[model samples]
Target: MKRIQFQETGRICQVPINDIFGFMYLATFIYFLPVTGIIFIYIAILKYTKRSLIIANVRQLGLEQTRYRRELRFIKRILILISIIFITGVPYLTFFLQVNIGQSPMPSYGHRISFMFLSCGQGLVMLLAIFYADDVRKSLRNILLQKLPWIRGRRIGNIIS
Candidate 1:
């Protein structure tokens, strides 16, 4: 019967510092893994390609310009994956924490806090992934343009001989 507001203006509950810290630390750690994965993916590409990292990176960027429907499909898949991970992990974590850690005398909202942090962390990863994809698309587009300048317009049109 109680409704929790997603945003609020005043203090509603008190939480223990350790629980809060646990939430933040765990969330940040999980978030870092995927980010590290993305970075390593780039590094691996650079090593294998034996090309300028800058050029290679730009080449990847052009994937974004694909028609809108494909982009939307990719975005939907990423979001669904993010949601599934959070929904599955958060409840399991909450149960584990409650069972092992014991609820506070004041009635713990620790799970809620932890979920907030986790969701934020997951959101960060999803957002970064989207940006990385777009960067790859743009970079590829740029590389193509550089290699074939005439795709957009005449090399030297109206002004001279």
Candidate 2:
């Protein structure tokens, strides 16, 4: 097997390739398996929701005017979260595979930056969820205003968005 070793700040990281069961192959598969499942489940939910709503003729009810709108908003938020995770994770995947496959040498800082971005992906998702909830967002905004009263007249809500 081809093995790569790199050291930074008194720490060394190694990756081994050249076989189907290599570190790169196994790690990438394990990491991406959940992503694949999330996308699959999202699609299934979208299809089920749309089919059921349409069959029920929600538009004719004269009361559920926001049914599709609400459903789409919920689904769109989920899609955004998934996209954030995948997009942020791509950099590390590329860097790892490129190095392990011998296409390029991994720059010491590249992997670190990629890992930071990947780690922050979940944080971004959490922030999105928190800000999207009406009560939480309002409470947070109020707390911010209370803590920093100078920016009261300005667009504090815009910052949360």
Compose the digit string of candidate 2's lDDT tens values, residues 104-134.
7667577577768978997998899887897
TM-score of each: 0.28, 0.70
Model 1 stretches with alpha carbons more than 4 Å out: 1-23, 32-66, 96-161
Candidate achieving the largest lDDT: 2
On the 0 to 100 scale, the lDDT of residue 46 in model 2 is 99
Error of 2 at 80 (Å): 0.7
* Candidate 1 local lDDT, 37-149, one digit each (tens): 65566456445444443454566555533433454555465555555455646663665566556753323554566667667766766665664575665665667668877
**lDDT for every model?**
0.52, 0.74
Measured by TM-score, the strongest candidate is: 2
Where is the poorest 10-residue window by lDDT in model 2? 10-19
Q: lDDT, candidate 1, residue 142?
A: 68
Model 1, residue 15: distance off in Å is 18
Which residue ranges in model 2 land beyond 4 Å of their true spot? 1-30, 56-59, 144-161
